[model samples]
Target: MGDTANNTENAPKKSFFKGVKSEFNKIIWPDKQTLAKQSAAVVAISVALGVVIAIVDIGVVYGIEQILKIG
Candidate 1:
């Protein structure tokens, strides 16, 4: 009974890896130029978003400080 339970647990893991391998094999990887462009776009967008968030955060902090001073 114990052996059967262990085998059942391992069976799912084995099948999962097999399925993952099959899916990976089907993927069409991007070429070097396309990959480089995509990576650069991602980096640029991330930096822009970070700057916007930082500006918003600073504005909020300054507003809070002004309110505290008024109080």
Candidate 2:
């Protein structure tokens, strides 16, 4: 009975490792040029978004200061 329980617990772990190996075999990895282009695109968009948001935030703060007579 104890041996049966031990094997039952080990069965899932064994299957999990086998499944992991099979999945790694099936992956289609991106090549170097595609990877670089995608990375640069992500960075450019992120920087443009950050600059726009910062400008909007500064404009809001300046407007609020004018309303409160702080400037």
Q: Top TM-score: which candidate number?
A: 2
8 Cα displacement, candidate 1 (Å): 6.0
Angstrom error at residue 45, model 1: 0.5
RMSD each, Å: 3.4, 3.6
| Full-model lDDT for every candidate | 0.95, 0.93
Model 2 misplaced stretches (Cα beyond 4 Å): 1-10
TM for every model, in the order presented, reads 0.72, 0.78
**TM-score of the candidate numbered 1?**
0.72
lDDT score for residue 20 of model 1: 95
List candidate 1 stretches off by more than 4 Å: 1-19
- Per-residue lDDT tens digits for candidate 2, residues 1-71, read 79999887777577789999999999999999999999999999999999999999999999998999964
Highest lDDT: give the candidate number.
1
